[model samples]
Target chain A: MDTAQFNEALAHIRRFETMLVEDGALILKFWLHLSKKEQYKRLKKLEKNPHTRRSVSKRDWRHAKLYDQFVKTAEQAIRQTDSGEAPWLLVEATDWRYRDLTVARTVLESLAKHLSLESAQSEITTQSKPLTPTGTLPSTLTILDTVDLSQCLRAQEYSQALETYQGQLHRLAWAAYEQKCSTIIVFEGWDAGGKGGAIRRMTQAMDARLYRVISTAAPTDEERVHHYLWRFWRHIPRAGRVTIYDRSWYGRVLVERVEGFAKEKEWQRAYLEINDFEEQFAKHGNVVIKFWIHVSQDEQLRRFQEREKIPYKKHKITDEDWRNREKWDVADLLVKKMAQLPEQTKN
Target chain B: MDTAQFNEALAHIRRFETMLVEDGALILKFWLHLSKKEQYKRLKKLEKNPHTRRSVSKRDWRHAKLYDQFVKTAEQAIRQTDSGEAPWLLVEATDWRYRDLTVARTVLESLAKHLSLESAQSEITTQSKPLTPTGTLPSTLTILDTVDLSQCLRAQEYSQALETYQGQLHRLAWAAYEQKCSTIIVFEGWDAGGKGGAIRRMTQAMDARLYRVISTAAPTDEERVHHYLWRFWRHIPRAGRVTIYDRSWYGRVLVERVEGFAKEKEWQRAYLEINDFEEQFAKHGNVVIKFWIHVSQDEQLRRFQEREKIPYKKHKITDEDWRNREKWDVADLLVKKMAQLPEQTKN
Candidate 1:
């Protein structure tokens, strides 16, 4: 058989499930089990019978010889893929009648359960109040509204403070490295919120070798294929190093949530997931610093106009920035909700 | 001082080496040490003088209490950053004059050595034969060229064999998960060599949740800012999962080497780096499988044309594929060299 045709056939089998179930997909799997003695007995019978002789090939005997390897491999696969939505049923195949009966019964049970679920869902849709998108948090006051965005620094004062902090950060970076401690600095802000300037100031003070500034952009095709958090996990700094995110996983709740890019349930669950992710960093004794750079709407507008006038900075101002600005109120509310979550879950 | 100005001051103090030295960078560091009693006496003197009083802030007094922490952090930094090219010199600062003299003498000595080495390099260039690229391996026959591309599978046989192998692979994947063993499969082949087909066949048989197929492309901005291999290191599968690389870190030698994307020296040293990386995976008990799918030039051309005729597959055949084909011989030779490196370095 040509490899291409074989691969095509394999593709056909795979189309049953192109991706893992993000929600639930009904899938039934059965594993037939036979003792070595029983397998050997069956093999001999197949070889003797003309109708089944073709099925008992030299490869079959070779596989039987490596039965232990097969068993171990099967056990691992079953364990990894076993979940509430999709499960494997191990059947004793020594007796064909028993194996068939057990498989048939299991399939019927699953079908009945699935039918009941479908009917129940329909009944609920007709009988209950329309369901809101899953994962919406209650509206409440948040730290965001309390921030004093009107606060401004004089040029001389800004310069002096920048130098002081940069110096401290440099020394602290070296200290952290010496102690084999890693650091993750997250910057979340509005458009033209001076994230770029602040990150530049920080990087300028540290040894380029000890820190990396990860400018988060749209997810790549490979990243888009995996869990949302997988991309962030891939970039965690090693011991004693620093990774500064220009924007970060908060996008799942911020941009992704406000823009409706992520389902309500996905963003809702993200609070717990993000908290868990941060806890792992804390457990590893990494310094985790998060900064929310805030700016007033008028100041943001001024910066946008200034960026447009400066040829070099024009690219930084985009249609998306304007679009995001329009939904600032929604983003503000969501961010406030997110901020409260960490404090609640901190213990 | 405002925070900005403080940060600017901090940046000024951080003019020391900011990043790790990828190549040798001339650097000199001095660790000035003073006895605790001497430090206390100096602090008292500074406090008495109004001019020096401004330099000694409340933070300085706070830091004095954690002198041990400072010492430990400094020691660690020195240890980690110490290399033959950029060594740290410890100087006793009990007397300011002695510390200054020691540092000055060390700097002079290092400068003299560097000058002499620079002259020696010029002389060598004039007197000796041209230097070969560093880390060039000896030419040797490898498994790559020995593959018989003409060996083909019939359609019926291919279908049957694929089913058998996919079944085995499916089972093995599960077993690996149960045993908490991760797997890494690397695919490197000629354009249109059916790598995608083979990978699909393997993935089809296993659960999507158990494995990830990473299609390597040009590095992202974040990836570009770090070491070339850092991106690959970020994606290593956790225990009980499988990661398949469509193209991998081997690109340093293959594409980067052939296309001049990497310097001659950088690609040359990658063989050892790659060996070390694989050894780490092996030590972690990962099942590593590498495939070099062989196909004749005629077959490759045929497939390329076939892809062009199919609307969905047309995008797969790009101008780059045609260009890459022009350098097939170079890639083949480089690959052969790379294949032999693992065997030599296994010990």
Candidate 2:
């Protein structure tokens, strides 16, 4: 899409009122129009007036010359978006008074019509629920059930396997650097499921200078200023390097969803947003690896009890961990529903 | 040491002129004094004045009550630091004009004496070298000679050895984390000396989230605003994490020294400063590891040639690399001399 078309589409998508229009909500848009001659005359007047001269620039004249092109694109946008629930009102802006009056009349007329329709609908179905449809997940079964919690590796076998994998990973990491390929590994798991241990196993085989481990925690003041994903984007590895994330953006769907930290609509829309984000990574030819270390509820409890007896490990087991355990089933259900999201989102 | 004695020692050490006092340089020191009653009287006057009210605070009043203690410490500092060349000129600061006049006269007298001495010395030693002594290294031999370049590992042995070490490092890293011990690893080496390779081996065994590799390059505008060491200090890993430096602050003494980027005296004094810096790390129970990869001149040349023939590696072989190779002997001599510094400095 051209710049103008893209900007118009972005504006539409960003406006919550525009989205609501699709659900039969009233939304009236006004397009103020001025002819090329009228725009140039106004520009000249602005330049001549000392009060407005500072606001005028060379770019103003430059864009004025392309007024026809802008009008064509804007007209196309209006036609495409014009609908019964969200109608566009075109007002000729050559005269300020006429433009203002037309815009005011259009808004008042739309509001009156919407109010009348709402009143009639309320009278006809006073006992019925509102007809807003909520989107449903594709699956209800928790993916946690599929994990074989009983699976365990003997200490000796685990050591041997770790050695083999580390050796291979060491070589592969160098090859990746030589080939200018970047890799990102994401670790998300249940409490005390050995995510840190597994991550350590992979990093042990790589060069200290070639990878960075980002342990996600509460967002800093600077991070909170931007979109939630901005912090993650800022740490994306440079070419031929690796970035490993502990926990990750999935908290928006998992913990945030279960804890009601995010609104229902916000978490529901995050699935598509996350998919688009990962799609960009795939497009950039980055290798994305994700792991969910699964462990049984009994094992987690046993570990927590064991941690309480160890001085160094005691801090890792907190009252908050115990509180979170109480909501395991709720989290489990939400996670399973999230698992039904397209696998492509994990990339 | 008490605060007053500490400041006196700090001032003496920080001033190059003070150090040169033994060499017959004329140095003047100043110690401003005010009685407890006089200071409190002035502070009250300042507080009552609108122009100085902004500077007054509860802390100032609290400190005012300690005026007698401060006076005792100041007198002790002045007596301890009294020297023939850099004599302390104590001025009663209760009266501003008297204090200013005393300071000005002291500086003027010292400057006159210094000028006359310099003129006399120049006349007497027209052909003789100055008596200032330069600190010399203990030896002229390059430490590179101590490295056995003939050392090599076969492919199979290298793989097996790498796995064993990686496993050990992995466990140690976790232990360090649990114990809240930070680790710093410094890498320095000749071109094609496999610094990157060795670093990769060590990092591969670590958890990706527990370590960060910092590759030093030219300082950015922000970095240039602070001391050269500030950049390195800013990246020091938090508790339980590892920070690996590809090259480090040693550049102030190494590359900057040989390349004439730093003055002779600057690099000369860096030894003590760096020693103190590393001593702090040791005191904090942080593990510090340093490595210097050694490669024979012939081996480096062969590797450079090999890199030039490989498509991906060719970019690593540049004209700058060739130029640096030409100064190998000079760099080798300087590096060996630096190695003679106390072992604590290396850590």
Best by lDDT: 1
lDDT of 2 by residue, B1-347 (tens): 67765875545444434445533456678888777788788889978975446457899999888887777776776776676766888788988999999899889988988889888966764332211213244445555567776788899998998898888888788778779999999999888888888888888888887899999987765576556677898889899999999989888887787676665655667776666666667657798888888888899999999999999999888998898898786677677877777677333
lDDT of candidate 2 over A1-347, digit per residue (tens): 77775765545444434435423467778888888888888889978865446457899889999998888878777777776666778889988899889888888888898889888966774332211113244435556677777787999999999899888887778778778888888898888888888888888888787899999987765566556677898888999899999988898888777666665656666676666666667556788887887777788899989989999999888999998887776666667776766678343
TM-scores, each model vs. reference? 0.43, 0.39
Q: Report the C-alpha displacement of residue A46, candidate 1, in angstroms.
A: 24
Give candidate 2 regions above 4 Å deviation.
Answer: A1-347, B1-31, B42-58, B75-90, B100-143, B153-184, B201-214, B218-243, B260-277, B280-287, B345-347
Lowest summed lDDT across 10 adjacent residues in model 2 chain B is found at: B126-135
Q: Which docking category, incorrect, acceptable, medium or high, applies to candidate 1?
A: incorrect
Cα distance off (Å), candidate 2, residue B135: 17
For candidate 2, give the lDDT of residue B43: 86
Q: How large is the C-alpha RMSD of every model relative to the true structure? A: 16.5, 34.9
Docking class of 2: incorrect
Q: Cα miss at A56, model 2 (Å)?
A: 54
* Candidate 1 lDDT over residue span B1-347, tens digit each: 56565454334323223222332346787888977667778888988975345446788888787888779767756666566656778999998788888988998998898778877865654322222334244456788667776687899999999999888887777778778999889998888988898899889998787899989999876677677877888888889899999999998888887777776656666776676677667756777778877787788889989998999999999999998887766777777777776462242
